[model samples]
Target: MKDVKTRAETLRRTIGHRVVDGKDAAVVTVSQSYPTDADDLWDACTNPERIPRWFLPVSGELRVGGRYQLEGNAGGEILTCAPPKSFSATWEFGGGKSWIEVAVIPEPGGYARFELAHIAHPEGDHWETYGPGAVGIGWDQALLGLGLHIDTGAAVDPSEFEKWSLSPEGLGYVRESGNGWYDADVAAGTDPDAARARADRTIAFYSGT
Candidate 1:
């Protein structure tokens, strides 16, 4: 198993807002570098069969302009697809529509840098109640799973991940990830005090403490 703290610390996150179609939208960006080639990393993320091994099981048509759904998760239409590099899609969940883009960039020494950006409407209530951690933490966990799978070439047990999320080490990782997003929000012009408060709530929700 990987050291939770070290892995969590390695993740980079950014929480910012942008105006899309004249509406304010919040964006959460998570990025990490994996020890693999870009093509291999791209295959792991885009190939439906391989995705389930690391992330969630995905079904339906997967090509550009095709609709796809992750089992018990989000459903959306693929928007942009550039082989071994990037893909953008609409993320529809909880009766709301958002946007997601994933990019795999080649780095030196055969490392692949994975980046994901999730953009959605600013939640007046939930955003203040939980801040970016609600989303950032989720992505952080997914990135962790992906990194582990890539490094070890093994399927991560979903049940074990669920149980780990409640463990003390996992809770520590959650808190740290939440704090990272809180800083990002502050840097993006959010009130520091407000952001910190929401981060506290988010950490509590994920840690169950």
Candidate 2:
């Protein structure tokens, strides 16, 4: 693998989700500036042959309103596609429909700003039982993988990468992301303390704490 430039300095932000109708619906936004041209980054994301190198093996028609499937992963309808600038799709996973949008904006110095947003189901009894440390953490890892693949041209297996989510560093990431979710839950009018406690327990369960 090539030496990928570190984006830790520019990871910028992580915002958690607000609960809606007793369900834990959340959004995670991650951004990074890559030292590559916009077209290259765009192709990496939308090009079928190149997608599996960074994400999952995706097979589908490359057009708006086309249905596509990610090998062993989520499959959904393409809601929008604006070439090298934006792509939005319905991310159907675990019998639920969510939204994923990616935007690529060019910077002055041969760089591009990439932002990913995942809008998920809200917090509820089902969310509480399933735990708080689920989707957000997974998305965090996916963003990391995107960064690595863009910089190094190497792909990280999602399943293998998930194992790292249970490691010490991974656990820390989970804790932080979970706390963000809890905060968002509170902001959305949920019980803050209860949400935090539930999030902590979920982290512990995943981390063996």
Candidate 3:
């Protein structure tokens, strides 16, 4: 099992937001380096069977312009696909449309760097309410699962892992991540007090603290 520190390091992801076409959208970016070929990393992300082992169980045509759904998660349309390098998709959920992109770049020693971004809807006061915490926490968990799945052909079930959110270690990580986002929110010129308060509520919700 991976230690809490290792998992926490993976959770040190970033969140960015902006208004696009008069709508508020949040983007969550997570990156990690793996000691695997770029082709293998790309396959793990794009392959249907392998994807569930790391990210979510996915079913779709998989080609560009194809529609796909993640088991119990978001469903979207594939926008672009460049094998062993990059892919983009339209992520639709909660009556909003977002975009996700994944990029894989080769490194020395048969390693590769994988980066993922999830862009959220740009509208309403939702950005202020849930922008940072939403993307930050979610991607943190996703990256953690990805690291595990890549190293070992196993994944923590989403449902079961959600329950772990209430554990002491889980709550601690949530609080820490929320605080990190709080800092980013303030630096981004968002109202720090409001962002911090929102983070508090979000932490409470996930951690049951």
Candidate 4:
């Protein structure tokens, strides 16, 4: 298993807000480097069967302008696709429309970097209540699973994840991830007390504590 403390310190997380086309949106960005070639990392992310191994089971046409859905998760339209490099898509879920983009960058020594940005326009009180950790934690967990999958070439079982999340180590990782995003929010100008409170709620939601 990957070291939790190492990941918490190594993986990069950023949060910011923006107004796009007259609509305000919250942006969450996460990035991590993996020990794999760019093509392999891209395939691990975009391949239909491989997705569920790390993230969630996904089904869709997958071509540009095609629609796709993650089982009991987000569904969206594929906006753009560039081989072994990047992809952009619309993220629609919980009665809201958002956007997501993933970029794969090649590095020296056969390593690859994955960067993900999730943007959503929070409707009334949502941002104050949950903050970025609402989705950021989920993405962090997905990234962790992806790292494990790449290192071991074994799919993560959902049931195993459930039990692990309740363990002390898992709970600590979840809490730290939430707090990391909260710090990012504060750096982006959110009130410190408010951001910390929201982080507490996010941690509870994910850790089920």
- Counting clashing residue pairs in each candidate, in order, gives 0, 13, 4, 0
lDDT of 3 by residue, 1-209 (tens): 35655566544356677775677677777677877889888888888878887678888788998999998888989999888899999888777788889899899988888888888774677665665776677776676677777777676676666666666777777777777667766776678778788878777766755
Clashing residue pairs in candidate 4 are none
Query: Per-candidate TM vs. native?
Result: 0.96, 0.73, 0.85, 0.95
Per-model RMSD to reference: 1.2, 4.4, 2.5, 1.3
Clashes, model 3: 4
lDDT of every model, 2 decimals: 0.89, 0.70, 0.75, 0.90
State the displacement of the C-alpha of residue 150, model 3, in Å, after optimal TM-score superposition: 1.6
Best by lDDT: 4
Ordering by TM-score? 1, 4, 3, 2
Report the lDDT of model 2 for residue 15: 47
What is candidate 2's CA lDDT for residue 144?
Answer: 67
lDDT of 2: 0.70
Q: Encode model 1's per-residue lDDT on 1-209: one tens digit a residue.
A: 56878888888888777998789998899999999999999999998878988899999889989999999999999999999899999999989889999999999998999999999897659877887888899999899899889988888899998898888788888988888888888888889999999989988888877
Model 3 C-alpha lDDT versus the unseen true structure: 0.75
